[model samples]
Structure formats: C-alpha cells, structure tokens
Target: MAKLKSLMSCAANRLQQASGLDQTEARIEIRALMQHSLGGVNHAWLIAHGDDTVTDALRVRFESLLARRIQGEPVAHILGRREFYGRDFAVTPDTLIPRPDTEILVETALDRIPPDQACEILDMGTGTGAIGITLALERPHAQVTILDYSEAALAIARENARQLSAHNVAALHSDWFSAVQGQRFDLIVSNPPYVEADDPHLQQGDLRFEPITALASGTDGLDDIRRIVAHAPMHLKPSGWLIIEHGYNQGEAVRSIFSGHYFANVHTVQDLAGHDRVTLGQLT
Candidate 1:
C-alpha cells in the first residue's frame, strides 16, 4: 500500500515538472489513464490517499511516459486512441490526429447528404477512418469508401472501422482515385494535407509526431486541396457535393479552385471558433 502511494506521488510530481500541467490537468489525465486500464490506477489512488512508498520498476515506467509527454508527444499517440465525432478511433504515428475543426467538415457533410438515400460517399485521405467511419455509422445505407496512400495509415483506419462496427465503409489503399478507377460517389470529402512544407507549426506539438505525408502538402500548402478539387468532379455524381477542410486562410483559394470547375454553390463554412475552415461546392 505504501509502495503504491509513493509511486503515485512520484508520477504526479514528474508529470507536473516535465509538462508544466497544473495539478488538476495532470490529475485528470492520470485518472483517465487509470480508468482506461493502463495499470496506473492503484498507484494513483494510493497516492491520492497519501501513501508514499513505491517500487522502482513502476517509477521508471511512469517517469519514461512523463518524459515523452514533456517532449510534446501527443497524449493520443501515447494512449493509441482519440475521440472524434463522439466515436473513439485508433491512431498512430502513421496517420494524422483527428482535429476538432475537421468535425465541422463531418457535420457539414452529414447535413448535405440525405440520410435516407442510398448514396455513395468517398473520403479521401481518411487517416484513422474518423470521417468515413462516422458517416458510415450515421448513414448505414450509404456506401462509404475511404482512400489513403499509406498502407500503414489504411491498416489503422481499417481497425477503427471494424471496432466501430461501421461495416459499410470500404478501406482502400489508393493515392486519391487511382485504385478505384471507374467508381464514383454522390459526395466526396477530404481533410487532406494542407499544411505548408516549411510551416513553423510542423515542428511543434503533436504535429511533430504525425506522418508528414498526412500533414504537409506543398510549398503553398494548397497542393493536396487543389488536387482534390481538380479531380473530385471526375469521381462525383452530377449535383453531388464535394467538401474539404483546409487551413483557415485557404478557404478563398479552395473556393476559387472549385469555381474553376463545373462546381456550383461554392462557399466556405467557419468552424465553431469562427475560422474559415471548410469549403464546399456541388458538381453541376
């Protein structure tokens, strides 16, 4: 009992020192780690109870995790999971961490597509299957196909799909539409790599641990968004909607890309934070 208490105190101290997280945030995270059965609960509970004698082995492991977190490793990567659109998804270094801004994209897509209609939807660059899987779960009758270039990313996405029981989603290893040549969908959505290659943010926080292929587009960061806009019309049914998430400042550029095509209703949607984060257009 004393050992458990000591370990918890040491862990909390190390986490606080390493990450500069206040007592409340650190305690909350530690509690979640315990609740998730990561084997730290007994120590945490004992520590909270004022026990102070912990084993060397447990101390070493806890310190290691604290060090990693202090280095800016995302908690999601450390835990191997993230919650997106009210669903938990398996995440890894191979894919991008699903962001809250992207939820606006999913919500927008759900609003645009008719739930009762048996429509085909395509999710391009579906890292962790968050967008595609959510759509499949919400619109069971909709046939959803998720395409990603990286095999490792696709593997994680497939696992997320299975875990969520979203059977209607088809995971495809493709660079955009290359593998699914003749197939088309009633709606196409993507939260593709829109970060500029040399963006300073890429060197910081969770982005540091994410795969570059899933984050950086090109010099201007519009490379992937432009490609999706240019090619989406080819894979979208007439009158279908193509929605995309981009850097807050890229909305106008994305909308212009759509205007150059046969797409109509070209516009942008702001996220809850009031950033122009999503752009949508309909195939005419």
Candidate 2:
C-alpha cells in the first residue's frame, strides 16, 4: 500500500504525462482530488500525514477521479460544484461550469449598480445562476431574474439559488426574452454560448462533457449574441446597462454589435489574462 504522499506523487506524475500540465498544476489537481474524496482533507492535512497509509476506499475514489481527469473531465464537473465570486455554486452537465472570467461580469454589474438602490437585473442564459445569484446576495435590494432555454439548466440554477439562499432571485424558462415579455430591467448580464459550432477546441478538454447548446452558438459563434443584442434593448429600461461574456476573440464583433444597435458606452473588459472577455453598453 502506498503512503499518502507517494500516492499523490504518482498521481501527479501520471496527470502530467497525460495532460501536459506542469508539475505544479498536476499537484494541484492531485490535491483537489485528495481533498474532495478524503473527507475534505486539505492540502495542509495531506502534507501533515504524508506517511499515513492510504485507505483502500479513499485510494479507489481518488483513482476513479484521476482517471476521469486523465480523460479530460473538468475538476469542477468531477466535484459537482464551482466557486464563483466568493461563493460555491452547484453545477452539472446541464450548465456551463462558472469560470473566473465570468466573475468580471458580476464585478462590472455590481460596479454599475449601487448596492443600496433597488435594481431589477436580468441574467440571460443564467446556467448555474452564478451571476444572478451572486448579484442578489451582494445587493440584497436587487431583484434578479435569471433565464435559461433549457429546463434542466433552469432547475440547476434554481437549486443553486435555493442553496445559496438568494431570496431576491427568480429562475425562469425563457428563450432569450420570450418569457419575460414587457418586463424591463435595470441591468442585464449573460455568459452565453459564444464558441463557434466548429471550433476544434470544443472537441478537446473539458468542453467535451459540457452541453453543446451551452457552449456553441453558430458558425461564427455570434448567433445567440445577436439574438440577445437585438432583444435586449426592448427588455432594458432607458439608461440600463447590458453586459455579456463572450469568447476572447469575439470582442470586436461584440463591441460592433452593441455599437450598431445604438448602445452607448460600448466597450470591452479584459480578463486576468489580458484577453477581452466581457462587453458592456447602456440603452439609449
């Protein structure tokens, strides 16, 4: 039987060989699996108990998870939750795993709308409800409505809203603005499907397990964005802001769409990697 540290080292080496991840990243993945499967044992605990023998059951679970990771499954998917904006959100195959880039949208939305004011917010294609729920929790006075075309996705979002105790949020089934007809919002945000249908990257890595509808838009990956942009003005109050997460390469196209629609203050915000990740504009 391998000791805890030996098992971790072996797992990390295998992960490095399988995924081309550096030693540091591989160790991080190993630590995450250990923490998740070993009664929430953290990195520090693993280090402290380096000489401890690995339990058969725990080792089996870790090996299973490592095999899934070797096959390109995302750790968030394997763990069944993702952390976003200082909170953990339940995620499943029905929804896109909330990414750190999307946090910029939440931050931007919060910055635009004052926390003390009563605000009506719409999260298009809300997925796991990360953006909408986080906004509701951050600004308790805000009423957030999250829409998703998929009932399965909406269910996950609703559950996340419940788990997170976001009382100000409501999840609904809507194809864009269809279900919310005639309702206007102070702000609208989305992390929609912007990956091109034929993007080769979709066939690789974590994208394989994620729902295609939640990841791909069209040949240009702008179809859903176009739909949202066209309908957003109708659902947004005058002077209301609309912010969206898009593919890094889609920034110029997104900015053009907003500008062409006569939206003022149109601009893109870069993520931590300095890649354009979010675009925002205000209704005239």
The number of the candidate with the highest TM-score is: 2
In model 1, where is the ten-residue run with the lowest total lDDT? 32-41
lDDT, candidate 2, 145-213, per-residue tens: 999999998999999999989999988899889999999999999998999999999998788899999
Give each model a TM-score. 0.86, 0.96
Per-candidate Cα lDDT values, in order, are 0.84, 0.92
Model 2 misplaced stretches (Cα beyond 4 Å): none
The list of candidate 1 runs beyond 4 A from truth reads 1-28, 36-61
Query: Clash totals for all models, in order?
Result: 2, 0
Question: Distance from true position, residue 123, model 2, in Å?
Answer: 0.3
Screening candidate 1 with a backbone cut-off below 3 angstroms (N, C-alpha, C), the clashing residue pairs are: 3-53, 6-52
Model 2 gets an lDDT of 0.92
